[model samples]
Target: MRISRLVILGGFLTALLPVALLAVGYTLKTRALMLDTTLEQNELFSKEAALYIDKVLVDHRNVLQFTAQALGADALDPAQASPVLARLRAAFPLFDRILVAPPSGVTAFAVPELADNGQRVAGANISDRAYFQTVLRTNTAYIDPDVLLGRTSGAPVTIIAAPVPGPNGGVSAVLVGTIDLDSLTQLIGRLHLGASGHAVAVTREGVTVAHPNARLVQQRFNFSGTPVWQYLRGADQGRIASYVDEENTTRFAAFATVPATGWKLWLSQQHADVDAEFYQLLASSSLWPLGALVVGILLSVLLARMIARPIETLHATARDIAAGDLDRRAPEEGPQELVSLAVAINAMAQTLQALVVKERGVRAQIESAVTEYGRFAERVADGDFSAQVMVDNAGDLERLGHALNAMSRSLGLLVSEIKLATAQLGSATAEILAATSQQAAATTEEAAAVRQMAASVHELRQAGESVSRRTQAVLDMAQKTEVVAETGLHSVEETIRSAEQGRQRLETLAERVMGFSERTHEIAEINAAVAELAEKSNLLAVNAGIEAAKAGEAGRGFAVVATEVKELAEQSKAATAQVRRIIADIQRSAQAAVIAAEQYAKASDAGVSTSRQSGTSISTLAARVTEASQAARQNLVAAEQQQAGIEQIALAVDNIEASSAQTVSATAQVEQSARSLHDLAQTLDDIIGRVSVRPGAERRVS
Candidate 1:
């Protein structure tokens, strides 16, 4: 069962058991005490009944004594005797008759009723009866046996006798009082001790005197035959007897002896009557104890349930705690101990709930930190180092984030430095490339200038070649002119020799000339033709001079040619003159011919020297031009090399620029990562600040 049920049941049982035991104990004790009390009450009732009966008997004896003393008076008159008898009968109702017996054995003067009937016998010696005999013998009052007497009428009676002494100290008469047994029996019948309880008067000899039943009165009671009589006879005087009666009915009997009458008074009660009050009392007492026991048990159960309710709630909370519901709590209301337990349990639950919440928060913080770290790592791996995370106020997490941020910042700074270096290197390389390009342009210009110089030198060499060829042609023309002059001189000399031979032939031919003079006239005509030719030559010379003047400087060389022709003609004329003279001076003209030939030879020599000098100058000019062309080719090769070197440097600068760009990209990524880390540190600080901890909260980590 659940703890609550168990606790409640245990408490109920605990409260109920002792109360039930006490109630049962009380019931049992009460029953025993009530039984004893019932018996005692019955005994007391029996004693009261005995005393009532004894009082009646004593009253009867006092009447008898007073009557005896009245009868003993000394007046002794017949007139008084009748009045006294009437007075005695009226005074004592228990008396059947009041009779005076004289000492001389004479009856008293009888009443008229006894005289008319003659019922009285005087001096009859009646002392044989116990009351009469005792009164006469002892001079005291006496009680009679049970008898039937006829005074007014015959009835069973008990007689009381007392001695009347005569005036001189002698007995005068006896006064007898008779009591009706039937009347006593009626009184006994009216006396009620209890339901089924009766009063009885018995003689000392066990004869029934007065009884509730008239038939039993004045009868000899067989003491051994009836249980009530036997119990009364065996019982001590003034003691009660409890036994079954002759009717087989249970009874309580009490017996007392009357001192004056020598009679026994008994009060008899049925046991059912004596025990009736006890039965009702027992029922009430029994019910009281039982009701008390039931009420005690019910109250115990209710009280137990009330006490256990808080504990039960506490136990349920404990179960919830075991099931991992750390927030469960119990109401702290109950008995002192149970309330304390509930309070403690609630405190524990609150503590546990706080702990669980703290643990979960810590775990969440750790996971967040781990996730941020992972993101940082991913950014780094992707070369996007500029990513950063904000840190909250999360104590240790904040510190760790700050540390990561610092590291990232350092890395970013390093990347920035490298990027700066890369940019600087790129800029320097670009400047170098620009300078190299300028150098290449200058070299190209130098090469172009050298090429122009080479072309100029080649043109100069061609010009030199042309000049040499033109000089050679001039020398050849001069030589041809000298040869022509020599030929003209030879023709003149031959004409002179022919003239000398003709003169000899003319002497021979003077006759031939006279004959020839006729022929000479023909010949002279021929001579005249020759002379005309001479005249024509002179005209030609004159014409040549005029033409030279018309030609001016341009016709001078032509005029000289014309002059040479005229000279040849003139030489012919001169030859004619020389022929005329040669006839006479042939011998002298030989020397003159030799001198002209010498002058012509000298002029040829000078022409040869001038041609040689021109050839030498032309060769020197060709050599100088060939050297200048070689220098221009060398300059072209150097310019081509410089241009190639400049291009190579430009390509290297481009590569450096590309490297610088990549470095800048990397530096940007590093900056981004540093910023991200710084943000993460700030987030961690904020989280730490927001978290609440109780006073005296212990730190699990630094």
Candidate 2:
């Protein structure tokens, strides 16, 4: 709460801020750099180790491939491949054994032959081995991940095989070489990564190929479940990672992969070991800022005391002066700025003492002058401007006495002028009131006229709308009539076509009737000829009968013949008479049919003529109706236009009515204002009459 504490606190903060910031920034940057360097060094070591391993594996693969190519088809034969296989085994000591297997996966030849279960290694059937099958199937080189123990040496070994091509471009045999994994383990173990650091190599399946612990390699230990494998799995070339190991110790690991064999390598170190130096540097760096803070606090307290002491002395002096002790003064002895403030405070106290003495003298003069001015103000308030003040001293009171006299004279003159102006104002306002009353009456009449006109225009618009509606109905009816007329014309056309077709058919019927008449006549002629033949035969038979009588019994036979012929003649004559009658009936019916057909043709012709005439009349009626509809439509359009014009007129009239109404209202307000002005003029005359002015300052009353 005190100035001394605030000063001390402010100074301390200013001095310590930079030191604290510098310490923190340096600690963070240093830690980051050291962490990066540690990780980078571990990663670099893994890469170098991986490259070394890759080179060893590649060299072995190349040698095996070269030997396989050199042996070619001969690799399938034990006698032919023995010498070359011996040289391959002697050159690469890392290989425990070198052998050649035929397509059947049986070993045909092997260097340094060893017996397996009392059978020579040469005759061993390895067809079932996955590595042998892989070589045979892929027809390329392969490195097996399964570790095998040497039969004789009892050491970890793995197989790397290359296919030997035959003369037919097929694999004649597989050239397999066994690698001593102990050698790989020793090579990785040589890396000098700290006390807790070690490197190991594993296959893609996490099967250990080389490890510092030889027992793990011999047992084919799998690291797939460990945190180290989590970082190594599927890692392409190299990376840095950290995790808690199986031993419960957090470790930083760098992973690298051998490109030649797909084997993963990692160099692991304890977390504490990697960051040991970084922590030590951070601890030592914090000490300097802590000591700087302590020194800042001490210096701030001493400096704050020097500044606060002078200000505290000036505070006490100012308090005494405020309490009416004008003699008190601040000391002018500390810093230059403090001394200046002290002198200003002391000068203010002296000025206060001088103003107090002068204030007493001025107070008495103001009181004496106020008493004299009061009497004059009282007379003015009572409507009497007849008296004035007369002070002795020629100061503010003397000026006040002269001002009162002037105001009294001026009030007399002003009252006289107001009386004269009030009378004229009353007359002018009366005239204005009369004129405003007349204008209000005229505006009221105009408003009523405009309203009536607007009603008339609105009625006209309604009538026009009615006409438009009726015209639309007429047009609809006309459209229906036109459709009917068109249908009637089409019917007339069909009737005329039917009439023409009927006439042609009637003519054909008449020709058929004539042909029937001619046929009947031919039948009559044939019957006549038949009748004549019958009559002649009857005559012949009768003559024959006469001659029969002359010849007795022979004549009887002739008479029988004649009688039979006579009977045939009578039947034939009867048939002839029936044929003539039927012919005559047919002729009469044909003539009747011909006459009926001619009558029907004439009737159809008349019916068709009547239909055409009716259609013509209907068409003419439709045209007249359409014309009437168009005229009605034109009238409707004209009426609609007139309606719109009337509507506009109605709107204009409405607006005029409103304007006239507003004019009347404004006129009434003006009339009221004029009356108020007249009444005010009379009130002014009375008010001015109450005040007494000097003699001879009078005006005529209205």
Per-model clash counts, in order, read 51, 1
Give the candidate number with the greatest TM-score.
2
RMSD of each: 79.3, 15.4
lDDT of 1 at 60: 69
Local distance difference test scores for all models: 0.60, 0.81
In TM-score terms, candidate 2 sits at: 0.54
Query: 655-687, model 1: which lDDT tens digit per residue?
Result: 555555555555555555545555555554454
